[model samples]
Structure formats: C-alpha cells, structure tokens
Target chain A: MTALLTVDRLSIATQARQLVRNLSFSIAPGERLGLIGESGSGKSLTSLALIGLLPETMAATGSIRLDGTEVIGAGERQLVALRGPAAATIFQEPLTALDPLMRVGRQVGEVVRRRLRHEGLPSSAPAVQTRVLELLSRVALPDPERLARVYPHEMSGGQRQRVAIAMALAWRPKLLVADEPTTALDVTTQAEILALIGQLVREDNMALLFISHDIPVVAGTVDRVAVLRQGELVEAGPVSDVLQAPADPYTRSLVAAARTFDTALGRLF
Target chain B: MNGTAGSMPQTEGKMTRRTIPLSLIVGGVIVGLHLLAGLLTLFWTPYDPTAMVGGRLAGPSLAHWAGTDRLGRDLFTQILIGARIAIEVGSGAVAIGAAIGVTLGILAAFATRTLDDVFAAAFDILIAFPTLLVAMLIVAASQTASLFTAVLAIGIAGSAIIARLTRILAKRVLSMDYIVAARVAGSSWPSIVVVHVLPNIWPTLIVNLALQFGLAAMAESSLSYLGLGAPPPNASWGRLLQEAQGTVYTAPFGAIAPGIALVTLVIGVNLLADGLRAFADPTRRGRR
Candidate 1:
C-alpha cells in the first residue's frame, strides 16, 4: 500500500532551541503508526511541523508530503485548504481543542462548512447541522441531537474528547493526527477513546498518526511503532517486535520503566 | 455522635444561599434614574431650559424648583436637559473609543513584531498625557466645542487606555489553546477575531465601556464648566454650574442643583459598570 502521509528528514527550530531534527516517517492508508517519546522529546513539535501549524517564531526545513502535495512551503491560503479536508488533528486537551463559546454541534458544523466552502462546494446551515449530527453519532455519542446544542464546558472531559474526534472526522480527511488524544482522560475513558480512534481509522480508511508518551497506551492500538528521544528516532519496527525485544538501549529503558511502574502498582493491590 | 450532629447543622448554615450583591442594587438605582430622566425629558422639564424664569439668583421655591441661574433660566430645566447631553456624549464617546481601541488592539496583537512595537509605542505616548488635559488642548485649539467636537476630543483622549487594555487581553487570548485550534482548523484572521477573541473579551470590553462612559460624561461637564464645551444657550449642567458660581452665596440651590445632577449621573454609570462586572463573573454565578 502507498504511504498516504510521508515526512522526509523534517527539522524544526524555535527561537531558543531546536525542536525536531532530521525526522522521517510514513503511514499507509488505514494503518496506525505510533510515535512514542517522553515529555519534551519533540513528538508534538514534529506533529505541528507536519501540519504546518508551527508558530511564526519557529522555522521548519525539509519535506512534508500529504498524499504527494508539499506542505513545507505552502502559503496560508493553501494551508487552509490542506488543514481540515485533507488532514485533521485531535489534540491532547479536548477542552482547549474545542471552542468554549460555540455549541458542540455548531463547532463540528463549522469544520464541514469551512472545508466545503474552501473546496468551492455549496454549504447550507441545515445541511451542515445534519452532517454534524451524523458525525457525532458515528463517534457513538449518546443523544447526539441534544448533546450537539450543549457547549464544550458543559460536557465531561471524555465526552469532549469524543466530540473532538467527531470534529476531526467531519471533514472526512485522508489522514488523522491524534496528539495524546487520551492523555487527560481516565483509564477506562482512555481505553474507550483509543478503541474509538482505532475503529474510526479502519472505518474511514484514513491513515492514523498517534503521538503519545505512554508506550503501553499505543502498544495494542498501532500497527507499527517509532521511538523518539530528544527529536531523534531511536527505533522503528512492528509493534510486537518493539514491545517484545526493543533493540535500542533507550527504547529498552522506556519499556523497562513502564514494566516497573505497572508491577509496582500490581504489588500494592 | 453529638459532635457529628452539631457539625451537620453548622455545615448546613455555612451553605446558606448567597445574597444579591450591593453593587447590583446600586447599579439598578443608577439605571433607573437614567431611564426616568430620559422619560421625563421626552415629555417635559420644570420650565423651558432656555427661557428666563422669575429672576436671576431666585431662591428655591414652588415656582422655580431648584432656583434660577444668573441668566434666569430654571436650574431644574437645565439639569434635565444636561442629562440628555450627558447620555449622548457619554455613549457616543465610548462607542467611538471602543471601536478604535478594539480594532487597533487586535491589529497590534496579530501583526508582525515591528508593527506591534510601533503601535504599542504610539499608544503609550498618547496615554502618557493626561486625558482631560488633552481634551482641553483640543478644545482650545478648535476655539469651538459642539457636541461632535466634544465627543471627538473625549474619544481621542479615551482610546489609548482602551487600546492598551484590549491589546493585553487580545494577546492573552491569542496564546490560548482554542486560538491554536482555530488556526489549525484553518480559520482566517478576521473570522478568528470575530468568532473567537471578540466573544471571549466582550464582557471585559462592556465593563470598560460603561466605566469610560461615566468618565466621558464628567469630562464633558468639566470642559463645559471651563467654557471649552457646548456653546452658550445650550443647557449643559456644567454651563449651569458656571453661570450659578457668582450667585452661589445668594442662591445656593442654583449651583447645588447642577452639581447634584452631575454627581448622580457619574455615580449611576459607575454603579452600573460595577454591577455588570459582578454579573459577568462566572464564579459569582456558580456560587449563587
């Protein structure tokens, strides 16, 4: 299968420091690739750089191709076209990701309406609302109709993350980038969200790029894994192989830490 | 068991419902006065504000309610007319100031570093000068102060402060995660400002506007008192005060009437703004 999203030797630098340096990865359509790293390991930066969402102070060099279209030098107008319809991001903090003032339905509708308008397609308010409801339902949100009228702040954190996922799916993008989508959620909610994401990626036939600091969280979800430390990729292989026998010393250390943490909790019980 | 039972009652008492804020009561009274004054002025005044009634320096009586000014115009009539002027100048000046401030502040926050610095420096310099002094200088230079000129002067003087406040607020809002989400979702600058930043900062802007309205009303009265606002024959409270100054000892009510009108209106606006600030506080609402 052809890689739906590809990053070749991507490097990004902020004013004070280099964020991501010479990183490259690819994910095939309908395949999930996990990017695992510790805090400040540049995983989030790489994701931002890929989507051309880096701040003005940050400079990026190297190539990022979304279905063969170069995003590195894309203008603001072009980036707008690329963002929602072609690629969408589900951020870590769902509360912050969704607009607090807007109704959940309206927020979801905005993505569809905006993308349609950007693509020179007709968009009506009612049609957008209908589509928003459909997207919300697809994410298994109960009482999607009533829920749509509520604001982000009115919903629980898990519900908000579901809404965020619904918003990402609204535009029917080819690639979905979930940056720690379940980090703020409770354990059960996290499992449900991870499962929801996995289910959606398969159903939509979209490439999934899941970035997380927790190794075990992504272990059961992704088809393959890439370990990054301080902006450098340390290991890349099948998920089972990496989990069973991590060759890189840093990867082994991370796995050992996760094992120890899990064992200590088990002993307390 | 006795201690636990006692604590339950204490906790219940502690959770007693919060009362309405004092600021709300004061604000309601202030708003009520403005509404009453507006309604009263529409139909009638004590006497023709421009008409010479009884005699100059007449004491308070049933015939001339708050007494008569040096020009023999009824003080009560002038005060009512002054209310209309105050509301017009106050609301108009604040509207203009908010428009200029919000626009420039948003631009300063969104624009490149060099442009932002330039705007920041310019507004800083403008704010450095005392607002009332600047209004005085403008009125002096023009040599004529109509409603339009007075409002223009007041707005110009007030814009720097509003702009500075808006800039700080906008910058803070810009750094928030939702703004990043908007950007990542492909929202344009204008859309981002209108849909995101504007709604979030509206309560703050509204409170500030109300406070500025009160300030502008007082500024207009001050300028008029100094013979720099609202030409003669126009019944302004400040003009009434100025005309009543010489006869204050003989007809104290004449001076006192307009001064009270000015004071009440200022107090009303301030109270109203304070009430709104309290109302806008989400924590306050949550507690209630």
Candidate 2:
C-alpha cells in the first residue's frame, strides 16, 4: 500500500522544550496505524504537528507530507485548506472538542458548507442541514433529525463522541487522526466507539492514525502499531507482532501494565 | 434533587430557581422607571423642573412631592426630569466603556506580544490614576463639559477596568478547545472572535455591564455634585444635591430628597447587577 500521509524526521518544540524529536511514521491509503505512548511521550504532539495544529508558541522542523503536499511551514490558509478535505482530527475529549453553544447539526453542517465554499460551490442553509443530518445518520446516531437540533452540552459523552466522529467524517477526508478518542469513555462505551471508528475507516477506505496509550484498545482497532517511549519510537510492526510477541523492553512493560491494570479493574468490578 | 427537578417550571415552587425572572423584573422595573421618567419629561413634568413654585427650602407637601430646593425649584420634578440624564449617562458611559474595553482586550489577548504589552501598560497606567481624578482632570482640561463630554470622560476613565476584565475573560475563552476547533475549521479571525469568542464571553460582559451601570450612575452623580457633570439648566441628581446642600440644616428634605434618590437608584442597579450575575452563572443553573 502506498503512503497517504507521511512524516519524515519530524521534530516539534515549545519554547526551550523539545516535544517530539526525530519522529517518523506514515499511514498507507486505507490503512489504520496506531501510535501508542504513555502520557507526555510525544504521541499527541506528533499528531498535532502533522496537521499544523500546533500553537503559535511551538515550532516544528522536518517534513510533514499529507498525500504528497508538504505541510511543514505551510501558511495558515494552506493549513486550513488541508484540514477539512485532506485531513481531520478527533480530539481526546469529545465533550470539550465540540462547540457547546452551537447545535451539533450546525457544527457538522459548517464543515460541509466551509468545504463547499472553499471549492467555490453554491451552498444553501437547507442543503447544508440536510447533509448534516445525513452525516449524523451515517454515524449511527439515533434520531438524527432530533439530534440535529440539540447542543453539545445537551448530549451524553457517548453521543457527543458520535457527533465529533460525524464532524470529522463530514468532509470525507482521506485521513483521520484520532487522538485518544475513547479515553474519556467507559469500558462498554469505549468498545463501541473503537468499533465505530474501525468500521468507519474500513467503509470509507480512509487512512486512520489512531493515537492512544492503551495497548489493547489499539490492538483490536488498528492494523499496525508504533510504540513510543520518552519521545522516541520504541517498536514498530504488525499489531499481532507488537502485542502478542512484544520486542522492545518498554513495549513489553506497557503490555504487562495494561494486563495488570485490566485484571485489577476486573477484580474491582 | 427530585424536589428541585419537579419545581423547574412552577412560579411558587421554583422561587429559588426563578431568580432570572425576578432579576428581569427588577431590571425591567428600574429600566422602565427611567424610561417613563424620560418620556414624561419630554412631554411635561408635574411642575416645570426649573420653576420656583414658592419660597426657598419649602417642606414636602401635596404641591411638591419631594419639597423645594434653595432656588425654590420643585425637587420631585427635578429628580423626575433628571432621571433621564442620570440613566443616559450611566448606560451610555457603560456601553462606551465596554465597547472600547472588550475590543482592546480581545485584541490584546489574541495578539499576545509586544502589542499586548503596550496595551497592557497603557491600560495599567490609565487605571493607576483614580477614576474620579481622571474624570475631573478631563473635565477641567475641557471647559464647559456637556452631557456627551461627561459620558465620554467617565467612559474613558472606566475603560481601564473593563479592558483588564475583558482581557482576562477573552484569554480564558481563547484557550477553549472549541476556539481551536473554529480555527481548524477555517474561520477567519474576526468571524472566530465574533461568532465563537464573543458568545462565550457574553455572560461575563453582561455581568460587567450591570455592575458598571451602578458604578457609572454613582460617578455621574458625584461629578454633577462637584459641578463637573452636566452644565447648569440641565437637571441632575448630583446638581440637585449640590443646590440643596446649603439649606440641609434648615430644611433637611431639600438635600435628603436627591440624596435618597441617588442612593435608591444606585442600590437598585447594584441589586439587579447581583441578580444578573447569579442568573448568568452556569454552575448555579446546573445545580438547580
């Protein structure tokens, strides 16, 4: 498979602190790649740097190519253009990710209208609303029509996550970057959300870059896994190879920790 | 929680929860009184605000609701007419201060550099001087200040406080993920600020406006009392207070009438502002 999104020796820095150093990864067209790392291990920062979503305080060096278009040092307008139709992000906290004041339907509709405007297509409010409802339905949100009129704050965490997923898929981007999309969800809800993302990526034939610290969470969702520790990639291989037969000492430690944590949690329940 | 949930709509049942309605009523009453006074003055006052009905320092009677000042002008009528000037100055000055302050604050927050530093320094410098002193100096520098000039001077003096508040609120809103989401969605800076940023900070601004109305009213009255607010021939509570000050010992009602009016108006505004602050609080709403 050919790479749809590629990062070569990408380094991101905030003020005097280096976050992601010499990070290189790629997502093949229609492939799901999981980048697993503990907290502050540069996983999320690498993803943000790839999409040019890093704050003004941060600086990045090295190449970030999304479908052969270099994103490094791209102007804000250029980044904006790339954000919707080319690449989109699903943040960790869905509750915080979506705008509270705006109705979920309008927010989803905005992406479609914005993309249409960017492509110089005529967009009507009714037409956008219809498309937004359709997208919500596509995400398996029950009662799409009713849901469209509701604000983000009015919805449950699971429902909000579904809305966020719908928004990410609104532009039908070739690549979706999900950063701990299910971290805040319960175990059952987490399973459902991960399943939804996996199903959607397969159906759309879209490349997905899933970032999580949970080993089993990514194991069941992604095709390949790249493990990071202390801002460096420690292991990269097929999910089966990395999870079932872990190579790096850090990766083994993670697997052991995840198993123990799950066991402890199960005992608690 | 169940009892609280059940009382969400009923008036008596939700008395505690219905603070917003109560606030609206109070705000409406205060605003309505000011408006009615203004309209009545435009058409006619009970007696001419400037007219001397009898001897100076006359006590309250059926002919004069409040009494007569040293100049023998009807105190009640003067206050009724002056309500328009006081409300105008209070609301107008707050509007001006908020507009300038919120704009500069949001700009400084978004800019976040030497530009922000410059605005912060300027804001701090302006705020360092006592607001009354600043208003006095501005009024002193320009001889014969009109209603508009008084409002402007008060607004300029009040802007420093508003700007600092707006900057803090705007910075908090600017850091929210939805703001980042808007940016990623390709929203222009102005659009983001207006559509996303402004709406989020609107409650804060409303609370500030209410609080400032009370402050501006007191300031206007003080300035007028000091002979710096409105010129002669224009009715103001402060100016009325100044006129009655001389005869306070002889006929205390002369001074007491305008003084009471000023205190009542300020109290009403402050209470309404407090109510608004509570009404606009989301956590309080959630608890209910």
Candidate 3:
C-alpha cells in the first residue's frame, strides 16, 4: 500500500536549538502508527511540523510528504490547500483546541464550508447545519442540536474533544494525526476518546499517526509503534512485538510503565 | 470535575454578564436624557432656541428658564440643542473611530514581517502623541471648522488609540490555541477574523469604544471652545460655554448650564465605561 505520510530525516530547529532531529517514519494507508515517547521527546513537534502549524520562530528541514505532496517547503497557498484536505490534526488540549468565542456547531461547520467551497457546492445555512449535526453525531456526541448553540467553555472536556474530532474529520482527510489528544482527560474519558478515535480510523481506513507519552494507551489504540527518545527514533516495530519484546532499554521501561498504569487504572475504574 | 473545570471560564463570563451595572444605568440615564433633549427640541422647544425669542441675559424665569444668552436666544432651548449637537458629535466620532480602528487593528494583528513591524512602529509613534493635540492639527489642516469636520478630526485622532488597543487585544486573542486550531482547520484569514478575532476582542473593545465616546465629547467641546468646532447657529455646549464666558460674572447661568451639561454627560459616559470594564471581568464582578 502507498504510504499516506512519509517523513525522511525530518529535523525541526529554532535559531537557538534543535527540537526534533533526523526522525524518519512513514504510515501506510489504513495503518495505525503510534509514536510513543516521553514529554519533550519531539513527538508533538514532529506532528506540528507535518501540519505546518509550527511557530514562525522554528523551521523544519528535510522532507515531509503528506499524501505524496512535498509539504516541507510548500508556500502559504499550497499549504492551505494541503492542510485540511490532505491531513487533519487533533491536538492534546481540547479546552483550548476549540475557539472559545465561536459556537460549537459553527466551528465544525467552518471546516465543512471550506470543503464545500472547494467542490463548487452551495453552502447554505441549512446544508451546513445538517452536515454539522451529522459530523457531531458521527463523533458519538449527544444531542448535537443543543450542543451546537453552546460555546466551547460551556461544554465538558470530552464533549469539546468530540467537537474537535468532528471538525478534524469534516473533510474526510487522508491522514489523521492526533497529538496526545486525550492527555488532558480523566482515565475513563481518555479511554472513550481513544476508542472513538480507533473506531473512526478503522471505519474510514484513514492512516493514523497517534502521538502519546503513555505506552499502553498507544498500545491499546494503534496497530504499530515507533518509540522516540529525545529527538531520535530509538525503536520502530509492530505493537505486539515492541510491547512483548522491546529492543531498546527506553522502550523496555516504557512497556513496564504501561503495565503498571494498566493494573493501577483497572482498579480505579 | 472535568466538565466543571472545562466550563469554569464561561460560567464566570455568564455571571459577569448577568449583573446589570450601576454605571450603565447612570450613564444610560444621562446619555438617554441628552438623546431625549435632542428629540424633544426637534418637535417642541419652549421657544425657537436660536431665535431672539426672549430678552437677552435674562435670569431663570417662567418664560425664559435658565435665562437668555447675549443673542436673546433661550438658554434652556440652547442647552437642549447643545444636547443634540453632543449626541451628533459623540456618536459620529465614535462610529468613525470604531470602524477605522477595528479594521486597522485586525490588519496589523494578522500582517506578517515588514507590514507588522511598520504598523507596530506607527502605533508607537501615534500613542506617544496626545490625541487632542493631533486632533487640533487635523482640524487646522482641514480648515472647515464645522461640526462634521470637527467630529471627523476627533474620530481620526481617536482611531490611533483604538487601533493600538485593538492590535494589542487582537494579538493576544490570535495567539490563543483556538486560533491555531482554526488555522489547522483551514479557515480563511477573513473568516478567522470574523469568527474568531472579532468576538474574542469585542468585550475589551466595547469598553474602550464607550470610553472613546466621553473623550470624543470632550474633544468636540475643546475644539468649539478654541473656535474650531461647530460654526455659528449650531449652539454646541462648548460654543455656549465660550459665548457665556464674557458675561459670566453678570449672567453665570449662561456658563453654568452648558458647563453642568458637559460634565454630566462626560461623567455618565466615564461611569458607564468603567462599569462595563468591571462587568467584562469575572474576578472584578466576584469582588462586588
């Protein structure tokens, strides 16, 4: 199968320091690839670089191919076209992820509007409204009609994340990059969010690049694993192989930590 | 815990919005009275305000309340017309400032590289200069000296302040995560401005705009006092104040009526704007 996203020797650096160095990986179509790492291990930075959302101060070098388009040096015009259509990202914090001032429904509808404008389809208010509700319900959100009117701060954390997910999937993007999406949620909410993401990824046959610090959370969701230590990829393999027989010392400790959380979380829930 | 924590900021926002402020009432009443004066004078004044309907310099009396001016026009009628002028200049200047300021601020906030640097430099230079002095310069340059020209001058002067404040507020809002998310969602710059930037900046901008109304009134009065505001036959409060100056010792109500009206209107606006600022902040609301 053709790879949906392929990053070759990708390095992100500011004038002062290098954040992600020489990281190489690729996710095939319909494949789920988990990026397991600790905080500041450059997983999030790599994801940001891929989506062209990195801050102006930082620059990305090397190559990032999203759906076969070279995104590393794409101009604003190309990047805008490539972003939502080629790949959509769900960031870690949903509280800040959704626009606080905008209504929840309109936020999702905005992405839908962008899609409609591209297809030469009429984006009437009623059409956008129906699509927004459809997207909301697809994300397993409850009573999207009432939910749409409320602002971001009015919704629960999980609900906000669901709204965010609905927006990310509005264009049916080829690649879905979730950067520690459930990091802010409680254990139960985190599990539900992960399950929802896994289910959507499976159903859409969309390539997934799931970045997380938690190994089991990654293990429970993604089909394959790539372990990052600092800025470098130390190990990369199938989830079962990496979790059962980790090749690197850091990966071994990560597996042990995941098991510990698994049991500890089982009792709490 | 999660849902409550997530909704904390908005809940606080709702609470702040729930309380009807004292300043709004005071300001609303005073400003509302001025608007009432404008409307009342249009259809039914006690006498033709600008006409020589009463004996000149007459004291507060049954026929000529608050006395008459040097021109034999009713002071009370002139005061009512003054309210009309104040409303005209105040709202007009404010409208001009808000429209120009909000547009410039959003442009500066979203501009990149040299454009951003240039706007930043321009804002700094403008902020350092006093708005009244700059407005005088603009009025002198125009040389029209009418109410419309005066309002336009003051509005242009006030735009710099509004633009500076708007740029600062817009920059802060643009840096928020939701803005980043909107970018990721492929929202066009104009759509982002309409959907995200404007709404987020509105509360602070509202208070600032209201406060600008007070400044605009003061500016118009100062211009008129300096022989730079509305022309003759207008009877602006500032001109009334200026005209009453020569006969102050003999006919003090001539000056007192216009002076009191100006102070009352400005105070009303200040109180309202201050209350609005507090109303926008939940922590301040919690303090009360």
Candidate 4:
C-alpha cells in the first residue's frame, strides 16, 4: 500500500559536472523496478544515493525517502542504522563485493547476526550459523558446510555471487538494490544468477531495484521498467509496453539493439 | 590420460617443494642460531660477559672460543650478550613502531581530506629527517643515552615510515568494494578496522615490520658506536666493534667476530622479510 522507496527530482552532481538531473521515481513495497541505462547513465549513483552512500566528492540535492527516512542529508549514524534493515545492495563484481580475506560463512553470519539483533531475536553463535547455512542453501549453494569454510577467491564467480546474495538476504531488508549483478558473470552464469535473484525476490516479497544495461535481462527480471539516458528518465512503464512500443527514441534504440542480437541469434540457429 | 594425470600431480608436488623460497630456509636457520645463542646466554655464557676472565688479545681456545677483548673480557661472552641486546632492541622497537604506526595510519586513512593531508604532511616531514639524526635529537633532548632511550627513539623514528605505509595500504583497502559492503551491512568503524582493515593489511605489514626489525637493530648499533647505546658493563656488538677499532692488525678477531654477528643478523632479517613477502602475497602464491 505504501512506497518502499521514493526519489523526488533527484539530482547528483560532481564538482565539475552534473551526473544525474531532475529524476523522479518510487517503488511500492514488494514491487520490482528495472532501471535500464548505459554506462555513466547515473543508475548506480541514484542507487547509492538511496542508501545515503554517495562518494564524498559527489553531491546530491534531491530528497530520497526510504520507508519515510530522508536520506539526502541524513547523518551517518542514521544512514548506517537504516542501510542493512532498509536496503541491501549487491554490487557489479561479486568477487570484490565479498571480503576476500574472510570466509563466506562468516561474512554471511555477520549479517545474519546483525539482522537477528535488529529483530530482537537470540543470536548465539549456533543460531547465527544456522541462519547463515540456511540462507546459503536458499541461494541454491549445495554443501553449505564446506562452502562456508572457503574464501571468496576459492569459489567460482556464480558461487561467489550466491554468497553475496546470501549476505544480502541475511539482512531481510525491505528493498534489495542489485547493480549490474550479473554483468561480470559468464552468459550462462548470468542467466542463472538473474533467475536466482528473481525467484528469491518473489519468494521473499522484497522490493528490488534491478539495475542493468542488458535489456533482455532487465525485462525478464522486473515487473515495471524505467529507461534512463544521460541521467534523465526517458521512459517509464510496464515491461511489455516499453519493449513492444517504446515512445522515446533512446528507449526504442535500446530495445532495437537488444532485438538485433535476438534476431542475429535466430538467424544463426 | 589417467597416467599423465597421476604423474602430473606428482611433478606438481615436487615443484611445490622446490618452490619453498631458499631465503626463508637460510634466514630461518641463521636467525634461529642467533636466537639460540641469545637464549643460551640467559642461562649460561663462557664467563660473566663483562668479567676479565681471559687473557687479552688471546686467539680462539677451548676455554674462550672467540678469545678475549683488550679488556680481557671473553669475546664469546660479549658476542652472546650482544645477541641478547640485538634481539631485545629489534623486538622492542618493532613492537612499539607497529602499535603506534598502525593506530595513526588507520586513523589517517579514516580522516577527512584536510585532516588526512595534515597527517600526510607530518609523516613526510618526519620521514625526511634521517632516522639516526632523529634518534640523536631524541637522545639529546632526553639527556639520557641508555638502551631504553635508544630503542624508544628508534621506534618513534621508524613509526613515521610504518605510519606512511599503513596509511597507503589502509586507503587502498578502504577503496575496495568489500569495505563499502561492510559499511552497508552496518559494520561499525571500529569493527571494520578490527575485522576488515587489519586482516587485509597485516600480512604486508608483518613483512615490512620484519625489515624494520633489522633497521632498528642496526640503528641501535649505530647509536652504540656513537657512544649513545647501552652504557658500559653491557657489551653490545657495536660497542665491541668500536672497542676493536684501534687493535685492528694485532687481534683482528675482536672486530671480525662482532662485525660478522651484526652482518649475519641483518642478512638473516632481510632474507626473512623477502621470504615472508613471497609467502603472504596470494598473487605470488598462484604463480608458484
């Protein structure tokens, strides 16, 4: 009934130049929103601003309300308090997203313990470990016991991404912001990771801000789509409407580019 | 295919064995022997290190293996005591440097732009001053030139280099994506430092500190040679070297014994540092 995240005329600027200007959007609770854009299109910056984690050099003027807390100029204490419980982010590179020095289980266990504490539940070592393994298994990682013992470098990319996902889910946050999460994975692994994200979001009924440049991947993952170019929102609507009949020339070009690949694949087959 | 696979692992095993860096072994043995000698002196030496129990300028003999100095103190006894002092100065200085430097470096890494710049400038200024000069100044300011003062001065001087290194390493780690993830996961700053920053930086820090141990030992000796080290009744290697300076042709053993000890210890420490670097770096491990 209420919006999980609201961005009002969000404008982000570095000292030299403006990166995102006059952008507005809101995602209702449990809604899936795909933010489609090219590199430097300000999608990542916007996501960062949502959690009040913008780089120090960059400034944001717009208001970002996450479950009613104004994040634009919030104190670090407030932002930190809200970050894990309000929104959890999955970055582009899974290997780098997880601390390489730490074992996967401990990383996930940290979040699980925090979440348990946040929820006022008992978070003893055994309890925290159980939740960690459960979340790891929930992400379709087999032999959670053994996987927990290995470092991030020891795991394959997909496995690492799953560990990242497990960490994100450990918080049980209201919104999950995945920024090009599959971009670094191989093609087959990308599809698997995307499906995992989609299924997990559905099962948890968690709102998702799925950011990616790949049109098909975004299309298959999100319920509604918003197309951005050069930091401006060019188009926003249901997934089918935009892909089938894009109003903006930039949106049409993006759709056409993805379609061209589809047609080329069809011809090859 | 199966035969090749079986033999491939065997060859890989042999390669792994051979790849154990030679420096590590050599340095380990050398340091180990010195440590043994130092520890042995704790319970037993040929004679009281400062006592005139042996004949002056005597050559090596069963009673006194390294003969005796001009003071008629057993040379072997003095050398063993020197080993003890060397170990003490090395470990004490490095421990102090790491404690102070690591704290300052991590704090500087977390500092705001202006504050970080201030810290950087301070570190640079401190580093620009020669370590021995800084130690000399500290000794002059304190008006006392004992072993404690020398170690404290060397440790403080070395802190700047360690701090500078730590700041750079910490900044690099802070920029990594996992650090952002840690913050986003609500990790407190202290916890982040303890959990993420320290573990990530400690391996390289250890290697640098090992090298610093060698430098600190040398600095102590230099101070002693300049008449600022442990006072008389304590024969440090450098003090022995200084004492043997005038008697060069007559009894070369006096200079050679202590000189050999100092050089070997330094070489051993340097080799240990190099070996540690190769061992701790994961990228290098992969190549091997």
TM-score of each model, paired residue for residue: 0.91, 0.91, 0.90, 0.94
Clashes of 4: 0
TM-score, chain A, candidate 1 = 0.96
Candidate 4 ranges with C-alpha deviation above 4 Å? B1-25, B274-287
Best by lDDT: 4
Global Cα RMSD, each model: 5.1, 4.0, 3.4, 3.6
Candidate 1 backbone collisions, by pair: none
Q: Higher-lDDT candidate among 2 and 4?
A: 4
Write the candidate numbers in order of decreasing DockQ. 3, 4, 2, 1
Question: Model 1, range B1-288, lDDT digits (tens) per residue?
Answer: 121122222232234344566777887787677667856887988777777877877887898778777777777777777888888889888988988988899889988888999999989999999989989888777777787788889988999989988988898889877777777777888888888888777768778888899889889988898888898877777788888788778878887888888788778777777677666543343344
Error of 2 at B57 (Å): 1.7
For candidate 4, give the docking quality class from DockQ: acceptable
Model 2 clash number: 0
Give the distance in Å from residue B282's predicted Cα in candidate 1 to where it truly belongs: 6.7
What's the DockQ of model 1? 0.24
Residue-level lDDT of model 3, residues A133-174, one tens digit each, is: 999899887777878877776777888899899999998988
Cα lDDT, model 1, residue B169: 86
Write candidate 4's Cα lDDT for B74-168 as tens digits.
99999998999999999999999988999899999999989999999999999999999998999889998899998999999899999999999
Tell me the tens digit of each residue's lDDT in model 2 across B1-288: 121112223222223343464665686677677668777898888887777886778899998888888878888888887888888888899988988998888888888578888988988999999988998888888887788878988888898889988887888888887776666556667877877777777777777777777778888888988988898888888888888787778899977877777776766676677666566653344343
Proportion of native contacts kept per candidate: 0.32, 0.25, 0.47, 0.40
